[model samples]
Every structure is written in structure tokens, then in C-alpha cells.
Target chain A: EAGVTQFPSHSVIEKGQTVTLRCDPISGHDNLYWYRRVMGKEIKFLLHFVKESKQDESGMPNNRFLAERTGGTYSTLKVQPAELEDSGVYFCASSQDKQGRGNTIYFGEGSWLTVV
Target chain B: AQSVTQLDSQVPVFEEAPVELRCNYSSSVSVYLFWYVQYPNQGLQLLLKYLSGSTLVKGINGFEAEFNKSQTSFHLRKPSVHISDTAEYFCAVSENPSGTYKYIFGTGTRLKVLA
Candidate 1:
């Protein structure tokens, strides 16, 4: 099966500009997640969606960041007026099962964003 | 709340030598442990996980991790390392796998395999 895939593998934008990263998860996977990792930092959870609805987004850094899962097949993470701190690697992942005890999550290659 | 700690920021080992990366966690409730690896220009991939059942879990690429509940630790180990094994490894933990939950990740340890 094809794993999670992300677009615009690398992007560089000026500060205060906007950028949107997209992710297409593995087919039939309902649990889609977004995570980010600043340079030299651990990969941190950003949000999660179960189909079309967001299950939890507590990990979201701030209001400037918005995530949408239209039709629940894919997801997009937009950063408005991006800041330098926003420059990092954004990872998208998906899990086939959420009700089970041990579900494996597959990840994308990640979209590297550099805000100057 | 849950937190993970990876004491070593980087580890260097010769190819074909044994290697171990340590991971520790703290949580009020029971936790599910995981190890993920990222090769150059690649996304994070699952190395191994510890939920229930046996304390020792083996994963892809001949990687293994032992979960010690008492120590609150899950350390990744390999009998022999390859040059391709060089990458960044992350340790993460979730308070509960079922229902709504988020994972807490460590600072990560970069393994550098020498030839």
C-alpha cells in the first residue's frame, strides 16, 4: 500500500507571508495527524483528525495555524503571517485503526518550511 | 500529562558493533512507548513499539527495544549496526493509546555509524 504523502517537500518564504502544507494519507485510513519538528528538536504532535472532523488539536502552537481535513481524505496546514520559529519540518501521519490497543502510524517524507 | 527524555543527543558507533539508545518516560497513567527513525530526506518511520504482551519487541531493520515498566524505560538495541543505520531516532510516549490522546516526544538521538 502507498504510504502517507506530502507535497512541496521544501519551501522557503519571507516572514509575515503565508504558507500551506498538504498531506494525502494512505487510502482508507481514517486517523490523520499532523506533527512538526523545529530544527534539532523532537517531533511534536500538532493535531489529529478522524475522518472529516477534528478529534483533537491541543498540540497546535497558536491561532495563526489552521488545519483542515476536507472530506477527510487529505489535510492541509496553513500558517498565516509565518514567523521564523515556524520554520521546521512538518510531518503527516495516518493510522488505520483507532479503537485498537496497538495501532501503527505511517508518516510522510515531511514538508520542510523555512521562514526567513 | 506525559513526557519523554532521551539523555543522549548523539551516539557514534562503528559498523557491525552493538548499539543502544536510551529512552525514559514520565506519566501519571500507563503509557504506550514507541521509537521512530528518520533517515536523511525521509519521513519518520516506526522502529518498534511497546504496548502490552512481551517486554521485548522486535521491529523492522533488525531493531529491537525492551520495555521495562519498573524503570519506565524503553531502549532500542541492535546487535550489529550498518552504515545505513545512521539517522535520527526519536522516543515518544502516550498516556493511553485508546480514545483521545497525544504523544510526547523526546529531544531525539542522532546515531552516527562509522565505517
Candidate 2:
């Protein structure tokens, strides 16, 4: 089975610009998640989607960040007017199970975003 | 709320030597523990996990971790290290409550295996 895949492996944008990162999860997986890691920091959760609806979004940093899963097959995270601190690696993951207990989460290679 | 802590930021060990990466977690209820490894320019891969069965869980790539619930620790260990074992190891914890899959990760430990 193919693992989670992310597009635009690396992105560089000027401050105040908008950038959108996309992720296509493994086939037949219903649980999708987004996470980020800033410089010298641990990987932090961003949000989670179960099918077409968002299961949780408490990890969203701010209002400028928006995540959407149109048909639940894929997801997109958009950062509007990105700031310097937004520079980091964004990872996408998916799991087959909904409860997540004893289930493995497969992660993507990650999209590196650099806001200058 | 749950949190994870990796005791070592970096560790260096010679090839063929034993190594250990310490991890501790804080949680009020039951949780599932996992260890992931990130190689250079690659995504994080699952090394091992402890759900409910045995305290000693063996994972891929000749790595193993022992989960001590009393001590709230899950330390990864290897009997013999290899140059390819150099990578960043992350410890994560997720609450076992129903309808929650969010994971709390540690700062990570960098293991540098020397040749």
C-alpha cells in the first residue's frame, strides 16, 4: 500500500503571502491528520479529519491557518499572510482505524515551508 | 492533557555498541506509546509501539523499547548499533479514551552512531 503523499515537497514564500500545502492520504484510509514542527521544536498536532468532517482542530495555531477536506480523500492547509514563524515542516498522516488504538499512523515526507 | 519528554537531546555511540534513548510521559489515564525514527530527508517511520500486551516491545530495524507503566517511561534500546542507525528518535503518547487519536510528542533524541 502506498503511504501518505504530500505535494510541493518544499515551498518558499515571502511574508504576507499565501501558501497552500496539499496531502493525499493512503487509499482506503478514513483518518487523516496534519502536524507541524518548527525549528528546534517537537512535532505538534494541527488538526484531524474523519472522512469529510473535521474531528478535531484544537491544534490550529491561529485563524490565519485554514484546513479543508473537500471529499475526505485529500486535505489542504492554507496559510494566509504567512509570517516568519510559520517556517517549518508540515507533515500529513493517515490511519485506517478510527479509534487509533493499536493502529499505525503513516506519515508523509513532509512539506518544508520557508516564509521569508 | 498528556505530554512526552525525551531525556537526551543527542547521543553518540560507536558501531557495534549498545545504546539507549530515554523517554518519559505524563498522563492521568491509560495511553498508547510509540517510538518513531526519522532518517535524513525522510518522513518519520514507526519503530515500535506498546499498546497493552507486553512491557518489552520489539520493532523494525532491530530496535526495541520497554514500557514501564509504573515509572511512566518507554526507553528505546539496541544491542548493537550501526552507522545506519543514526537518526532522530521521537517518543509519542496518545490517550486511550474513546474518540481521540491526538498524539503528544517529545522534543526528540538524536542518535549518532559512529563507525
Candidate 3:
């Protein structure tokens, strides 16, 4: 089975520009998550999707960032008017319905966003 | 709330030498620990995990981690590491108490293996 796949491995855009990163999780995965890692910082959670429903979006940075999972198959994270701080590696992961130790979440190669 | 701390931002070791990466976590509730490795321009891959079995959990690529409850640590170890082991290692904790998928990750330790 293929692992999680992401498009546009690297993206460079001017400040205030918008960019949308796409993620396709493994087949039959119900839990999809988004995380970001800024330079010199830990990988922070952004949001999660259990199928088409948003489970926990408390980690979302601000209104400029939006994430959507349509048909519970793939997800897209769009950053509108992205700021310089938004530049980082965006990772998409997915796992089965299980949680904790038994749950194994597979990550994508990550989409590196560079906003200058 | 839980958080992970990796004191070593980077660790340098000669190939075939033993290496250890320290990971400390702070959480009010019980949690599950995990170690992940990421190669250059690659995604995170599970190295090993500590669920509820033995304190010493072995993982892929000849990696192992010991979960010390009292110390609140899960330090990764390799008896003899190879040059391919050079990569960024992250220590993560899953919210077991809440039964959620949210994982608290550390800043990561970049292991540089010398020839």
C-alpha cells in the first residue's frame, strides 16, 4: 500500500500571497491530520479530520489558514495572505480508527512552504 | 496539556559508535511515547513506540528506547549506529488519557554521524 502522498513538495511565494497544499492519505484511513514545523521549532499540530468532520481545530494558527477534507479521501490546506511566519514544512498524516500505541500514523514527504 | 523537550539540538557521533538521544516529557496524565526518524527531504517514519509492554521497547533500524516513568523520559539508543542513521529524530507523545490522536512532539535532535 502506498503511504501518504503530498503534492508540490516545495513552494515559494511572496508574502501576502496564497498557497494551497494538497494531501492524499492512505486508503481506508479515517483519521487525517495536518502539522507544521517552523524553522527552529517543533512540529505543531494544525488540525485533524475524521472523515469529513473536523475533529479538533484548536491548533489552527489563525483565520488566514483553512483546511478542508472533501469526501473523506483527500485534504487541502490553504493559506490566504500568508505571512512570513507561515513559511515552514507542512506535513500531512493519516491512520486507522485506532488510537494510542496500536495506531500507526503515516506521514507524507511534506510540503515546504517558503513565504518571502 | 503535554509537551516534549529534546535538550540536544544536534548530536555528533562517529560511525559504529553508540549514541543516545534524550527525550523528556511533561504530562499530567498517562501517555504513550514514540520515536520517529526523518531523512533528508523525507517524512517522519516510526522508529519505535512505547505502549504498555516492557519498559525497553525496540524499534526499526536497530533503534531502541527505554521508557522511564520516574524520569518522564524515553531516550533513544543505538548500540552501534551506521552512517545512514544520520537524520533528524523526534520524540513524540500520544494523548492516551484522552484517547485522542493529538501528539505532542519535541523540537527534534539532528544526529550527525561521522565517518
Candidate 4:
């Protein structure tokens, strides 16, 4: 099966602009997650989706960041009013489920978002 | 909450030499651990994980990690590494079991394999 795939390998936006990053998980996978890494920082969890429902969003950085998984197969992360600090690599991942049985997560190449 | 720390930021070793990358974690409850490798301009890939049972877990690419509960450490090691092994390695922790996928990764260690 194909691994997780992300669109728009790179994006550039100015402060106060809006940008959206897309992720397509593996077929039949029920879990989708969003994570990102800032300058010289470790990757961090942003949110998780199980099917079409959000499982956890405690890691969301702020209200300006929004994520949606409408059909449960793919996801989108939108950053509104992007700030300079938002320039970084956003990674999307997917797994079979949350039971830790098929616990391995497959990650996308990541979308590099540069907010000037 | 869970946190991971990679003791070394960078380690350089001669080709075919043994190497060890140290990782430690802090958590209030039982946790699962993982090692991931990231090549240049590539996404992170799972190397191996320790959910339960065996303390020593072997992963692909001739890498292995020993989970030491007492020290709360999971250190990655390889008897002989190749130049292709040069990459960024991250140690991650999660509160859930092996199936629950949420993970917290370390700052990462850059391993450089010299020829």
C-alpha cells in the first residue's frame, strides 16, 4: 500500500496570509495525525483524527490553526494570518488505528511552509 | 505528559565502527518508545519500537535499541554502521500502548558516518 502523501511540497506566504496543507493517508487507515517542526525544534503533535471525528486536539498551537478531515480519508491543515514563526515543515501521518496493535505511523514527505 | 531527551546532538563515527545514541524519557505512567530515522529532505521512518515484553528490540538497517526501565533510557546501537547510516535519529515516547499512535519525539541526534 502507498504511504501517507502530502500535497504542495512547499508553500510561501506573507504574514497575515492564509495557507492550507493537505494530507492523504493510506487507504483503509482509520487514524490521521498532524505534526510540525519549527526552527531547530523537535517535531510536535498538533491533532489526531479517527475516521471523520477528531480524537485529540490538545496539541493545536492556537485558534489560527485549523484542521479538517471531512471524509476521514484525507486531512487539511489551514493556518490563517500566518506569522513569521509559522515557517517550518508540517508533517502528516496515518496509522491503522489507536489500539497500538498496528502502532506504526507512516509519514508524508512534509510540506515546507514559509511565512515571511 | 511525556518528554524525550537525546543526550547527544551529534555523533561522528568511522565507517564500520560501533555507535550508540542515547535517549531518555520522563513520564508519570507506563509508556511506549520508538526510534525513527530521517534522511535528508525525507520524512521520518520507523526503525523500531518497544511496547512491552522484550527489553532489547532489533530494528531494520542493522540497528537495535535496549529499553532500560530503571534508567528510563532507550539507546540505539549498531555493531557496524555504514556511510548510508548517516542521518538524523529521533527517540519518541507515547503514553498509549503500541497501537495508540500519538508520539512525542526528542530533539534528535545527527549521526555522521565517516569514511
lDDT of 2 by residue, B47-110 (tens): 9999898899999989999999999999999999999999999999988764547889999999
Candidate 1: regions farther than 4 A off: A98-101
lDDT of 4 at B85: 96
Could you report the DockQ of all the candidates, in the order they appear? 0.78, 0.84, 0.83, 0.74
Fnat values, one per model, are: 0.83, 0.77, 0.74, 0.74
lDDT (10s digit) by residue, model 1, range B1-106? 6789999999999999999999999888888889999999899888988888999999999999999989989999999999999999999987774465467899
Candidate order by TM-score, highest to lowest? Answer: 3, 2, 1, 4
Q: What is the lDDT of residue B39 in candidate 3?
A: 99
* TM-score evaluated only on chain B, model 3: 0.97
**Docking quality level of the chain pair in candidate 1:** medium
lDDT of 3 by residue, B22-102 (tens): 999999988889999999979999999987879999999999999999999999999999999999999999877554588
Candidate 3 residue lDDT tens string, A42-97: 99989989998999998999999999998999999999998999999999999899
Better of 1 and 2 by TM-score: 2
Candidate 3: deviation at residue B31, Å? 0.4
lDDT of 2 by residue, A1-116 (tens): 78899988999999999999999999988999999999889999999999979999999999999999998899999999899999999999998874444767889999999999
- Where's the lowest-lDDT run of ten residues in candidate 1 chain A? A96-105
Question: Per-residue error at A16 for model 3, in Å?
Answer: 1.3
The per-residue C-alpha lDDT of model 4 at residue A65 equals 99
